[model samples]
Target chain A: MRPRVALNIKSVDYEFLQEQFGSKSELLLKSNPVHKKIPVLLHNGKPICESSIIVEYIDEVWSSSPSILPSDPHNRALARFWAAYLDEKVPLFWVITAASEEEKNAAVDQLKEVAVEMEGAYGETSRGGDFFGGDKIGVVDIAFGSMLGSARAIQVRVGVKLLDEEKTPGLVKWAEKFSADPAVKDVLPETEKLVEFAKLLSAKFKAAAASDPLRR
Target chain B: MRPRVALNIKSVDYEFLQEQFGSKSELLLKSNPVHKKIPVLLHNGKPICESSIIVEYIDEVWSSSPSILPSDPHNRALARFWAAYLDEKVPLFWVITAASEEEKNAAVDQLKEVAVEMEGAYGETSRGGDFFGGDKIGVVDIAFGSMLGSARAIQVRVGVKLLDEEKTPGLVKWAEKFSADPAVKDVLPETEKLVEFAKLLSAKFKAAAASDPLRR
Candidate 1:
C-alpha cells in the first residue's frame, strides 16, 4: 500500500484539501508549475518533483520504519545505480510503443538492446540474488517495480511483448517478487485499469500525432 | 581541491587507471556501456554513472570531514531537487551552442526560459549565503558548479551569456560563490581550456549534423 504518514491535527485540513482537489489541486499546481505532474511530494509547502527523488525524501523523513535504501554506502550506491538505470531506460518502452510504425520498429530494436543491458546490470546471474542488491527489496526494486506496472500496459497497447519470462526470465521473476511484496502490492494500481489507461493514452497520442503537421 | 579518496595500498594502481580513463575508458565502457560516458565513479568494482549521483555517493561514502549535503531531510531534498533540475536542463546550453544558427536560436530561447525558471526557483532575493544551501558548499552546489563551468564555456563560444548578474542576479552570485570555493575551485577545468574544448566539440557536432540526414 502507498504508505502515508499519519497526519497531525493541523494537517487534517490540508489532507481534506488534498482529497477535495485531487490531482489538479491548486497546491500541486503551485508547487510543480513547470511540470504540473502528479507524484509531487509537498513538504512544508515546498514541492519536490520526480518520483525516485520523492521516494528518497520519504525515506529520509520517516526513518523509523523499514529503510527504503541500504545503509552501507557501496550498497546504497549500487541500489541507486539500478534505480537510475531503470528510470533512464524504461521511458523508451512507452516512447517506442507510441511512435509510428517505422519509429516503432527502431524503438523495438533499441528496447531489445536496452533489455540486454538491463539483464546484464540486474540479472540474477550478475547480482546473484533475488533482488537487485540481494535478499532485501530495496531502492532498486522500488524503482524497477514502479515501471513494471506500466510496462504490461504499453506492451498490450503496442502489441509488442517485451517482458515475457521466456525472454527475460530473471526480470520477470524479479517483477513477480516485487509485486508480491506487501508494501508494493498495497500501493499498485489494478493491472486492468492501468492497461485501459494506457490504451486511452496511446489512442490520444496517436490521434494528436496524426492531426499535428509539426509532429509529422 | 577535488578530494581524492585514498584507496588501500593494493588499489593505488587502480587510481592511475581511473585517472587515465576518460570517455573511452574500459572500466567506463563496461560500467556504462549504454551511455559510454565519463565521470563514472567505480566503488569496489561496480560503477555509478551520472555526475550528480556520483557526488552524492561520494558524500555518503566519505561522511567524515566535510559533508557535501545538509544533514536535515527537508534541506537535503531541496538540494537534490536543484541538482536534478540543473542536470536535466543545463545541457541545453551546450546543445544550443553546438547547433546550427536556426537550431541555435531555438536552443538559446529554450535555455533562457530554463534560466528564468532556475532563477525563480532559486528565489530573486538572495539568502546572502555563499552556496545553494546556507553556508557550506553542498551537493547541489557541486552539481551546478560543474555545469556552470561548462556553461561558461558554451556562453563564450556561442557569444550568448545566460548567467548574467543583472538577468539572474541571485544565480550569478551563487555561481560566483560556488566557483570560488576551495573544493570547487580546485576541481574546475580552466575556463580557457573548457572554451577550447567546447569549440572543438561544436565543430565535431556540426560536422556530424551535416552528415546525418535525420538530424536535418
Candidate 2:
C-alpha cells in the first residue's frame, strides 16, 4: 500500500498484487529471499524491498514529479532520519497487539512519545506548511502515513489514542491531511477493515502459539 | 569510523570528535537527539546520524568523488537493500558478546548464514569487479567494511570464523580488499585492539547486569 501510494504520487502505472495472510507466494519468496515480506516493488523485474527504499526509488526514477525528499542535502538527511525513525518503531506496533497488557501500554507510551517527536519533526520539516513534506506529501509523510491504518486500528482495538490532538496537534492534523490526500486516500486501507484483518491475524497467531508455544 | 572512511574516500577533510564510552557530549546529545549515538557527521553545523545515511549524505554533498551509490537506479536499490540487510544484522554482533554460550553459538551460526547470503550479494553487485561497488568501493562495501573490524575481532574472541574462505569466498576476499583500501586502512581498527575493547565492553555489561538485573 505504501509503495502504491508512492506510485500514485509519482503518477506511474503499476499492478497491485496482494499476498494472503499466513501464506506467501513463490514469487515473493524468490523476489525477496532475505526478508520474504510485503511491499516489495518489482520494477523492470527487479525487486526493491522496504517501503522507504521503494519510495526513494520511485522518487529517483520519476524525477519529473515533485521530489519526495527535499532538495537540500541536510534537509534530505533529516527527512531520511525521520523515515528511519518511523521504520524503527515498527516493532512497537506488533508489541501493541501481541504482548502482555503492560508491554502493550509501554508500546503505546513509546509510540505516543514517537508521535510527539514526529510532531516536532513535522514542524521542522513542514516549515508551517500543511504536510510533513511541506505543502506536498513527501517521503516522511508517506512513511508515517503508511502506518496510520495500523495506528487507527490500534486505537480501536487497544483503546489507546496515539496521536492525540492536544498532545501532537501537528501530527494529528498532518495525519488527517495525509489520509485525505488523493494519492493515498484510495490506497490507505479502511480502519474497520484493518480492524477485522487484525482480528484474523491475532487469531492466527494464537492458533500457531497453541500448536507451538515457542513459535517466536 | 564508517563516516570517516566515506569522508576519506570522498577526499573531504573533516574534524573527528570521539565520544567517550560511558558519557555523551552535550553536542552529541543535541546533534542526534533521537539516538544520541556516535558517528554523527556535523557539516556546517547540521548533524547527520546513522552510518549508511551519513555515507549517502557525504556522497550526495560531495558529488565529484567516485559515486558511493551506483548510478543505475536498480543497482542503487540493490545497494540500499544490501546495506539495510547489513544494518539489520548489527544487533547479533552484540549478542555475540553479551548473550549466553548457546545464544552466542546461535548468533555465530546466524552470522555465518548472513555471510553466505552477503557473498551472493557481493557476487551479484560486484559484477566481476573487486569491490561491492565494482572495483571502487561503494556504499555496501563501506557498510559491511565498517563492520569488518568487529567481525575479525569476533573471529578471534569467539573462536569462530563468519566469512570463511570456503563458505563465503567472495565476501572473505572482499573483506580483505576493502580493509586494504587506502581510504579505510588507517580508519579500520586493529583486530587485536578491537578484541581487547570487546572484552572491556563485555566486562562492563556484566558489571552493569550485576548491579541491576532488570536492565535490558
How many residue pairs collide in each prediction? 2, 0
lDDT of 2 by residue, B1-216 (tens): 879988898888888888878789999999999999888999997889988889999999999958899888888988898899889888778766666787687778778888988888888778889998588989888888878888988989988878876889888788888888899998999999888778878877667655632222
- Angstrom error at residue A71, model 1: 1.2
Can you tell me which runs of candidate 1 are displaced by over 4 Å?
A: A1-23, A43-46, A124-129, A199-216, B1-23, B42-47, B124-126, B203-216
Top DockQ model: 2
Cα lDDT of model 2 by residue, A1-216, tens digit: 778888898889989999988799999999999899998998888889988789889999998857788988988988898899899898777655555676677778788888889988888778878888589988888889988999999989998888987989888888888888889989989999988887777766656645631122
Off by over 4 Å in 2: A203-216, B203-216
For residues A1-216, write the lDDT of model 1, one tens digit per residue: 122211110122223223222237677778778777666766787776677777787777767546767788767776676677777765465555466677666666666665666666676323577777677666776766666766666566667766766767787777787777655665666767777666656766777766642231
The per-model DockQ list reads 0.40, 0.52
Candidate 1 CAPRI grade: acceptable
The candidate that wins on TM-score is 2
